[model samples]
Target: MTYNKRICVFLWLVKGGISVVLEMLGHVKLALKCVTERERIERK
Candidate 1:
């Protein structure tokens, strides 16, 4: 039972970590887009 519990916890942690990474990546992509837009306006 303890072994099963450990596996469950591990899987849950992995899932959570993946979601956090994905969220960070999305934010980074959004920030990059905003930066490019600002640069474009500045150049004009």
Candidate 2:
């Protein structure tokens, strides 16, 4: 029973970490796109 609890905790931690990483990646992607669009407008 203790071993099963440890496994569940490990999986939960992994899932949470992945979600945080994905959220950060999405924000970075949006920021990059905004930067590119602003640069294009400046060039025009």
Candidate 3:
């Protein structure tokens, strides 16, 4: 029973970690996109 509980906790943490990573990736992508747009505008 304790083993099962530990497994569940481990899985939950993994899922949460994955979500945080994905969120960070999205923010980085957005920042890059903004920088690219600014550069393009400056070039024009």
Model 3: pairs clashing at backbone N, Cα or C within 3 Å = none
How would you encode candidate 2's per-residue C-alpha lDDT over 3-32 as one tens digit per residue? 999999999999999999999999999999
Mind giving the per-residue lDDT tens digits that candidate 3 earns over 1-44?
99999999999999999999999999999999999999999999
Q: Residue-wise lDDT of candidate 1 within 1-32, one digit each (tens)?
A: 99999999999999999999999999999999
Candidate 1 or 2, higher TM-score?
2
For model 3, what is the C-alpha lDDT against the true structure? 1.00
- What TM-score goes with each of the models? 0.94, 0.96, 0.95
What Cα-based lDDT does every candidate model obtain?
Answer: 1.00, 1.00, 1.00
Number of backbone collisions per candidate: 0, 0, 0
Q: How far out, in Å, is residue 9 in model 2?
A: 0.4
Q: What is candidate 2's local distance difference test score?
A: 1.00
In Å, residue 35's CA in model 3 sits off its true spot by 0.4
